[model samples]
Target: MHFPTLATPFIFGATALAASLTQVSNYNNNAKAKPGMWVYKPDTVKSDALVIAIHSCQSSAQKYFANSKIPWHQGSDRKGYITVWPSSTTECWDVSSKASLSHDGGGDSNAIANMIKYAITTYKTDPKKVYVTGGSSGGDKDADELFGMMSNVLAATYPDLITAVSLYSGVPAGCFVSSSGASAAWNNTCSGGQSKASGEAWGNVVRNMYPGYTGSRPRMQFWHGSVDGTLSPNNYQETVKQWTNVFNVSTTPTSSKPDTPEKNYRTDDFGSNVEGIWAVGVGHSVPSHLDVSEAWFGL
Candidate 1:
């Protein structure tokens, strides 16, 4: 499937801030898919201090940003952060090949890198504060894939581009059940000896490729819902453990329940400034509006 172009009609209301939302057709000539980004530029802003590149699951860049309520104009008005939301080929991200299931080999990652370059070249964005984050499918599996791709290209194109990542409701790509019983409980899709072995191998590959990137691994904030059925909270825990073990960093995860209808769980490094939250009753949706606008930003 080819991504739709951004026509004047597509630019409605706040979407006008978008500089462009075009399809990138050159991912892989052989691939039968097209991916793109919903590029937003804050109006009346001359420069920006940060540029956030967002990755979405099945949803298009427009849908993701619209739903997430990431203010495009706010970047320019407040602190100056340009936000770009990139759409993946399939509803799910294909991490093994570092591309989308649409076979747009490297197209997704390339789009993000290209967008960042464009932002810097055009908007005078600070190269140092580039950050990445995703939720659900984008957050869970696609996040790692995007990171791996970024690690490979950022060094070459923008040597100074190092990004911090925050993942929500997703596990690192290479996690699986270890025992058959556990596998069966997980519906055997992620079980059996082969699944275990492959998962371990894949995990190790990710570790080696992205290691505990000192100064490279951006401060991470992971959030998951304890009751999430799509991706269990255990997956989030395992991912944190793996990352900490690999990085050899000491962190104390603090737990809490804020006084909202939905319970909130959070942890952080008291010293290093890495924090995460697991909303007790939330499902596969993005963090609550109150959390993102108030709690996350306030913190």
Candidate 2:
């Protein structure tokens, strides 16, 4: 082979590097990995509406995508909406502290919050339409450690970023009343004790979490199975009361839908939209559709 006098090895090396980078992109494209928080978009196309759906304990973002967990799937793709399912550092969100919201910034909550920001920045998600939801452990605390549960702490932090949150079989904020966390201690006070929280106790918790002047707090939507064995039914009703007090809505639901595809549901008219879904005959799972949540979020 003959080389041109002007040919240079450095030029050839640069071309090789570019080709390698191109190969990596092609491989990822074929692999179908979505950007930010290990999310899954209907298409790598575009979306303004975003759903930050966290998986239950021992689950991953891939599982949410595989099972079509939230309503952001199906017809949502065409509507310019996308859903993100992020894996916790170790299957749990550290919502105990506001700083935990950013990924690698601190606990799981920090990272998850960072993920939402990523979706918003990367996909240009609408701040108003932004929403959050989780399954059994996803919504509540992980039994393993009473992990920094989402519903318990969301009201306390990130009020500006997250518009609303949906909880399925979730735990209330005060379950961890002590500085030191232990499963046995939490289980004794919280496990199966489904008493509605004291209006003062929980209301104060939310108010303290969002201590500042005035602005609309994030709305709340709760769903729990009446027949859930792992979680107390009392907890379900109590959850409703907690949010009611936080939102300053009447304890009773204004709109109650008694018959769905599988279970009965209802929603109270809180100024900022706080609703509860009592699944008459379901378990620790997503009893209704994500579209139902869209309606709840007023999207």
Candidate 3:
């Protein structure tokens, strides 16, 4: 089943600063998928940063940008960062493919990496300041084929290319691969949240994405609804486990707070680099937190 757009209507009025939007088809020459793109450039470049916003399955880049109420472009207008939205050609990212799971392997992830490279070179944006965010399938792809997008996994596949990540209702990278060393469209173990492992073991999975790399890993922020049924709340728990292990931080949060943007939505800060936010009573379709996410990205 195709996921809903799951975005609030754009409510804010036009601001003083505005962004120019452009569409492109040939950003990468050797990418497995020739995904389309929607590029948003702020008139006044301030931070020299870049953000790549991914779309959900069966969704187009234009639809994701037009339907979502996220103020990322507005943030770009004010902060002077470039924003990019890429569409998946196969309706969903190839998270199940062996080529996609490996670094520099050709697939939608490589297309996205090429998009980032295109933006950095064409727009002269800072490579170190690149940030990524997505929702639902756009946030992650599962082995069960329940949903497919690779925002969170993209960072793990190319840690050096991404600086930070904010994922909503997504699963852990490689959560869909079966023990037989093959892609399985469905994996009840992981989707049900029964897949448990130490931080070290989970970290090993991400480290293997780019073998022999010791550079700084991208900081991550995970967001999930308390009652999301499609992906299961357990996916959130497992995601916390995977990333906390990747960051080498204690599973126990260093600090906790309520009334974040509203009551009942609690924010858990695991350490300086990892965080998880639980939206009480919310379901699988958690709207993107535009302002809060921008703040986390330091825009």
Candidate 4:
């Protein structure tokens, strides 16, 4: 399916690219093929800082574009950042096989690598300021596929390409010990059970990978709804704990305010390095007041 272009309240560059499926000669022809679409928006004013990518679960790039309320509309637009969103081949990211690894050839990671090259070559995006964000399943998988296993590819492909990542309502991919692992991880305790093993495994990978990086650790931000039901908010909390412990960061107050009488919240920074937030009354869905696209691009 194609992303539809709609009229925007602000004047910015926007374009939609069609979804395509490519064949990998090395992989089995019998292997399942992944297809995805991409949308690109360039900053209005030239920007040295650019956020290159954002994604969400089971949704088209077009949906993200439509939902984003760019700051330009509010008359407080920052210098434009390049925004790119890629659709998943399926409702969930393929996180099971070696092909799913970010370093795998012709996988989702490769797609992202290609997109970044295109962005810099075509849009004149800054290499140092590229960022990424996502929610739920997409957010989780992206952590590993983009940053964990594919770190080499990312660094090699765009040496200065990635600056930070913001994940909302999701744990790192491969963290769950079982389908039910979310329950234990969120609670900040692990019990012997046959839940999703992915979260646990992914957690170990993050512990090992992030700290040893020769480059600066990318800034990380995590936000979760306190009352999240589909995926426990606790899972997100545990993930934050893991990040803080590994990065050796401490918490400090950033913002504390109410969304409503029933739904207020606060944000805190971990040693001014990482950000973690809990939205008290928010649900499994995206918060109503935040613009997904703008948040992704840091616009």
Which candidate achieves the best lDDT against the true structure?
3
Cα lDDT computed for each candidate against the true fold: 0.44, 0.56, 0.73, 0.45
Off by over 4 Å in 3: 1-20, 135-149, 178-188
Mind giving the per-residue lDDT tens digits that candidate 4 earns over 26-63? 22222233435353443253565545334444455555
State every prediction's TM-score relative to the real structure.
Answer: 0.61, 0.72, 0.85, 0.62
TM-score of 4: 0.62
Model 2 poorest ten-residue lDDT run: 19-28
Give a tens-digit lDDT track for model 3, residues 72-175. 66677767778998776665666666666678877667778888888888889888889998744322322212222376668788898998888777778877
Candidate 4 yields a Cα-based lDDT of 0.45
Per-residue CA lDDT of model 2 for 1-299, tens digit only, reads: 44764477868756633311000111121111122256555533455777766665555556555544344445345454676666554544444333332223344555556667667777677877787766443222333222214644544456667788776676675543434532213344565764356766777766665566267767887776666666666776666667788777777766665665343644444454776677776655444366667776665
Which regions of candidate 4 are displaced past 4 Å?
1-37, 68-78, 102-106, 135-160, 176-203, 207-212, 250-263, 288-299
Q: Return the TM-score for candidate 1, rounded to 2 decimals.
A: 0.61
lDDT of 1 by residue, 51-158 (tens): 444544445676655554444334434543456556665653333333321112343344455555656665576666665555343233332223322322232222
In model 3, the number of clashes is 5
- Which stretches of candidate 1 lie above 4 Å from their native place? 1-34, 53-55, 68-79, 98-107, 135-160, 173-204, 210-215, 254-263, 270-273, 286-299
